[model samples]
Target: MLILAATPIGQAADASRRLAEVLASADVVAAEDTRRLKRLAAELGVEVGGRIVSYFEGNEERRTPELAAMLVEGQTVVLVTDAGMPSVSDPGYRLVVAAIEADVAVTAIPGPSAVLTALAVSGLPVDRFCFEGFLPRKSGERMRALTELVAERRTMVFFESPHRTEVSLRAMAEVLGEDRSAAVCRELTKTYEEVARGGLGELVEWAAGQEQGVRGEVTIVVGGAPSDSRTYAPEDLRELVAARQSDGLSRKDAIEQVAGETGTRRKDVYDAAHS
Candidate 1:
């Protein structure tokens, strides 16, 4: 059997009783960070009687098969990460997949997750939400990813490095609109936990002004665009077309502008204006 366990995100007392019990008696423990695992075990007063093995990003490939073999032998194999749940932007996904393929019983010890923690406190509408783990570090790739999500109607959640928070917010403002509502959660479940809520453009400005810089884990939540209103008047479309036309724009440019501003088809705008 393979047990993917969840560790505390920040507060030690948040560790569940079942997690401690399994850690104490499992036949083998696969940890992302052995040092942190040992500390957690000590804090919980659970003496790990089983062997502990390191299974992080680098060794996950090699360790998955070995761990699956142990599970096939009917030994209880427990997998844990440094924080939050296993396989959540962390190790244990590969092992779980391998265990499933090998016909081994695989389960999870659900516990603390930064994604949910921040989302819950964000004050933004969370009835419908999507988790976008982390944006690509490269500026171009990150912009491309955000462009695809521009029409996402559900509130979006994302994890970001403190150093890049400003840059990410700037890109989000550009793609998702400057006035879009968003929240930035920092150091969640800890004493210094903070949640900053404002427009994406406001956050970009705030981040730029911060000389001290941000620290600890961060989760950003942006509210979805409103879905109720869709009507546009003919007068509004005419005004848009006339403004673009007055800017020395071509007939094609005026029609395109009217279409984009009024959410009407370009052909309809062209036909209406020509007629």
Candidate 2:
């Protein structure tokens, strides 16, 4: 059997009793960070009895099969990440696939999740929602990504690094509109946890005011486009492309952004822009 466990996103007290028991008794424990796993065990007042191995992004591809093999050998292998459930935005998806392929029974100990935490406190409608793991780091890629969500009517959740929060907010504002409602959740479930709710434009300003950049783990929640949102005309598409181009995107990327934003064919957007 393969157990995928969830670690506390912030406060150590949130670790479940089942998590403690599994950590102490699993035949093998694969953690995203061995050191953090040790610390967590210490906090639980339980000593892990299993062989501990590292299973993180840097080595997940190489380590997944090894963990799966242990499961095949009739060992109870437990997989865990530094925070949240394994295989979320964290490392564990590959191992899950490996376990399934190997006919290993896989299960999870549900616990804290930053995506759900942020959404709950976002003050936005959550009846329909989607989680967009993380925005692209590059400006053009990020803009294109946001443009694709411009017409998404479900509330959107995104994970972003602290340093890139401001830049991401600005890009979101440009592509999704400045007045779009959003919330920036930081250090969730921690001592300094904060959730800043406002328009995209307002969030951008708040992030900019942070002298050391937004700190700690961050999650972004943005309200969806209105159900009755207006459709874009060819001229409007061309204008949007021009705006993105002026913001330093290449002509090709700008066209892609406008096409995604308006759900127009890329060729049509190109023709409209050039016409």
Candidate 3:
């Protein structure tokens, strides 16, 4: 059997009872960080009865099959990352796939997750939402990704490093609109946890005001565009068209491309541009 366990995103107290039980007795334990796993076990005061080995991004490729082979031999192989559920912008996905292909039974011990925790506190509509993991680090690539999501009506969640949270918020303000609602959650469930909720512009200002750079694990939740609102502002459309034009497209072609990209009719975009 293959068991995927969720570790604490913040407080060790958040670790599930089931996770502790599995940790205490699994035949083999593959951890993202062996040292962290040991620390967590010590906190639980339970000696892990399993064969402990590292299973992080750097070693998963080689280690996944090793663990999968254990499963094939009928050993209970428990997979865990440093925090949260496995395969959640974390490692463990590749092993899961390997298990499925090998006809191995796979299950999970669900517990604390930063994505849902952030979304629930974001003050945004949660009926519909999507997890976008992490955004590109480069300014241009990040902007392009934001532009692609400009029309998405589902609340979007992204994992960000503390240092890049402000930059992400600023880019969101430009592409998604300054007035768009958003929340930045830091070190959730931890002693110094913080959540800032407001419009993108306001959040950007708040991030800038952080005496020290934003710290800890960061999760950003941005409200979706209104269903009836134009996906792109007039300025956004114009800039997009201008970009296309600079790339050798005629004005008409640029408008057409921009309209298609924004899900607006070419006639409507043409009228908006000329208005």
Cα lDDT tens digits for candidate 3, 1-275: 99999999989999889989999999999999999999999998879997999999898799888988889999999988988999999988999999999999999999999999998887889999999999999997787778777767899999999999999999999878899999999999999989999999999999999999888999999998777645777777778888888988778767765774577877777876776
lDDT of 3: 0.89
Q: Tens digits of per-residue lDDT for model 1 on 1-275?
A: 89989999999999999999999999999999999999999999999989999999999999888998899988999999999989988998888888899998888899999989988999988899999999999987797677567656789999999999999999999878899999999989999988888999998888888778867888999997666356556566666677878977677766764565455666777766765
Rank candidates, TM-score, best first.
Answer: 2, 3, 1
- Candidate 2, residues 200-244, lDDT tens digits: the string is 999999999998889999999999987754667778888989998
| Estimated TM-score for each candidate | 0.83, 0.90, 0.87
Which stretches of candidate 2 lie above 4 Å from their native place? 229-255, 263-275
Regions of candidate 1 where Cα sits further than 4 Å from its true position: 228-275
Q: In order, what is each prediction's RMSD in angstroms? A: 5.6, 2.5, 4.1
| Cα-lDDT of candidate 1 | 0.87
- Which 10 successive residues of model 2 have the least lDDT summed? 225-234
- Superposing every Cα of model 2 onto the true structure, what RMSD results? 2.5
Q: Give the TM-score of candidate 2.
A: 0.90
Q: Ten-residue segment with the worst summed lDDT in candidate 1? A: 256-265
Clash-forming residue pairs, model 3: none
lDDT of 1 at 105: 88
Error of 3 at 241 (Å): 2.9
